[model samples]
Target chain A: MRDHLAFRLAYRGTAFKGFQFQKNVVTIQAKVEEAFARYFKESRRVHFGSRTDAGVHAYDHFVYFPKAFELYTALGVSKRKSFLSSLNFMLGNDIRIWEFGRLSSNFNVMEDIVSKSYSYFILSSPVEDPILTEYFHWIRHSLNLRAMRKAQRQILGTHNFACFAKSSGVSVRNSERGTTRRIYKASIVSRLHPQMKIGQILEFKFEGSGFLRHMVRNMVGTLVQVGEGKGTNIKSILRSGSRLEAGPNLPANSLFLTGTKIRAGLYAPLRPQTE
Target chain B: MRDHLAFRLAYRGTAFKGFQFQKNVVTIQAKVEEAFARYFKESRRVHFGSRTDAGVHAYDHFVYFPKAFELYTALGVSKRKSFLSSLNFMLGNDIRIWEFGRLSSNFNVMEDIVSKSYSYFILSSPVEDPILTEYFHWIRHSLNLRAMRKAQRQILGTHNFACFAKSSGVSVRNSERGTTRRIYKASIVSRLHPQMKIGQILEFKFEGSGFLRHMVRNMVGTLVQVGEGKGTNIKSILRSGSRLEAGPNLPANSLFLTGTKIRAGLYAPLRPQTE
Candidate 1:
């Protein structure tokens, strides 16, 4: 039990390429791993539930690190917490580490994730808000919520979502290899922010076994089209996987990776994710 | 009212200095006047609060242009909103025309202002939000709310805050003239953003007749120090308006030109200043 570790992390996506590693571009995975490497004084390998694309965000994300790993064995609570605390101090501002806890050796972030969900907020208002201009998708015209819901229903049960994934431009073989069974839990709910900007915020909560690359964002774009009275049969688009093209992806600033469903007997506490 | 003309403005403070358009460097006043001159196709005049510093921001802050002035009469609303909008729009995101409304010739954003108010929000948590980073100050330790409030009382009455205003290198003589202020209300409120990376935000609201240059920021800095257990005698601090050569200055990003106080009979609504 003492040979494993789990970290609950949350980050603003604006400054990161995504939760994975990449050169030149700043990615969340790179930063967090670097911190872990420094703290344990040796490299500790890590894993996450989803591979969020560049500009994606996480609310209560999790990371798993192995204890058999040589890096972190001798560390005490103050040293561990201090490592995180100092990273925040040194990194200065762009990212923050919330809290960490030791996990059982066999825990896996991806396999244990029960459901992975996302919420996309669109600020469809004519006026530019003095405050909220950064974190939302700003649309000028009103969107049709009912129509959008109708189109959203087309993506419910497990289907090969090869049509929804981004083609890496590698034309060779099986496009279907990337996907696993996924269930669309519920229709999106659209509401206005109560305090300041009077605009529409569309939220989609999906609890699924897993996800495909760009699948959620593409689905949202197609749904937004229906909401804007732009189209009708998105199911047919999915069936043939024909067009191989998606409409304008709403900006990543508004999309939030809210929660991840994890295995219960595994016992991961509800805490902010590591940096 | 039929002859009313709207204008878009841009300025490089590094050249003329701040928005006030001084002779020392490029003042915002001169740059704005230049834009209005080109828009009117001549050197027509306009009026604003004459505040805001170098590198400050404004989305659709307003200024009154005389209705009888025939300078921009040739330009239509679509052309005006579009052309001027494009000028800033083409320049980049840093510049935007938040909105425009036509008003009577008597409109004065300064004299007509009934409530002149500003806000400073600090990310008073150990975690720094990457997304909301540019919008708030991140303080590592918990603040002394009691001390902040005690200091706030000193901000209530009309006083010459000369010590608070930073000398603009330009050092305009009499710049501190008649700078006594009556703070209508001053208080701190904590806003909890559920999805925000940071746990809680502390905001300071300051409403006064008007402010000296960098007055609010300098005052906010002193208060933050008091809250952090670094300072004493907030009143004595305010009385020494000759500028603290080493006084702590709070971050400006968290500071906002939230609102203005104007005379009751202006075209746009403004809060009335009170003792």
Candidate 2:
């Protein structure tokens, strides 16, 4: 059996093209693999739990490697500080590995059966936030939070999400495999962060069995439109299963994969319901 | 009388060397002046409320320019959007101008008699926070919050702060001006941010009449040392008035000038004090 290691990682995603490796463009995968090579003096392919798009952040994404455990054992815990700290020191400031442990050879981050949670941050402000520009999607007009919360409830069930998925690159064979997926939780939270110039933060959290390409972004966009009074027929849109009816896919920078397991309890319930 | 314009500005200080104009490197002053040149079709020097050091962010710093009111009058309220919005559009994502109004020509942002507040964020985490690297200073060891809080109390009220101020480039003639200054408020607050991988944020807030060069950073560093049990005699540190006696000056990135006026109310009180 191949010795493997599993780790929980976080990254800003601002400097990276995406999580995947590409020939020339800088990417999270490429930087991570480069760090591994330098540390162990051997090349290793790090497999990420999700192939996130460019500008999509991950606060609790997983990474698996074939020989990470062996390298850690070779270094020996008693000889140095934490393996996570050692790896983090070599990696750039934009990425960090927070937790790590040996995994059974048969386990795969992508194949693990579990749900994942993501949070999308939106700033409702006329003035831009200099510090938060990289982290939030700023919408000048005020959002009707109550309407958005009500719309998200419609998302909490197993349904054919083909209307929300990006279909351009999906294989024809996979399309027939069915686009139905179960959503465990969905909610929108509004918060006042005084320190931020754009003080109003609208956070949207979605947890589901699995997501198709561009599914969450499209869902967020559609819900935002509903909140803005542009799309009122959410039920009809779902039943029709037409991609064209969904809202435009929002930007990737505001989306963050926050948790993998349902019980991770990374986020609390949205408080003081917005009216 | 010449007409002037006043505005509140915010910036992420990661890119620029500092707030003031420099010969070659990019600075906030240079960028603001450049924007003015573009809009007014004339060269104008933008005056700032404070000369911030490298990597220090400002949320409520002021800026003023002569003939700004004249330009606004020319545009009128109907023809163009507010000068603040126009300037923000031309500036990079790291800086934003949020508020603007006409001011009498005699007004000077620097001479305004008001208190200014600054907050320094420190992440008490063994591992780094990828997304917050630019926003916080990461400390690995556990800190004694109670001890730091006690040290901050000593920081309150007026005192000769020579021990905390950096003396190296200070003019020899200005040394006799006396290093004593009034500190209106000082405290350390801890918070748990779920979105940040480094959950513990120890925010240090300091408000006073004015700060000497590197004053806040050096004070925070000394307090951190006290919290770590390395320095115990806070009284001696104050009495010695020797810069060498204080702890190392902390990095500049964690420091943020939060507000220029106490009544601006940009920050809320620390809730449920840390033990």
Residue-wise C-alpha lDDT for candidate 2, range B112-189, written one tens digit per residue: 536788999998876668888888898876688999999889888988888888963244366433677789998888
Per-residue CA lDDT of model 1 for B1-275, tens digit only, reads 44344333322222324566466565555555565566445665657764677644433244555673344345687774455444344434333333334455665554555666777778777666666666678776677888988888887988877667766222445544366667888999876646544456888888887777778788888888888788567777666555653257765566666554346544532211111
RMSD to the native, candidate 2? 6.8
Q: Which ten residues in a row have the lowest lDDT in candidate 2 chain B?
A: B266-275
Tell me the DockQ of each model, to 2 decimals. Answer: 0.18, 0.34
Clash pairs detected, candidate 2: none
* lDDT of each residue in A109-164, candidate 1, tens digit only: 54667777777766665433434656667666677888887777778887766666
RMSD of each: 5.8, 6.8
In candidate 2, residue B237 scores what lDDT?
82
* Worst 10-residue lDDT window, candidate 2 chain A: A266-275
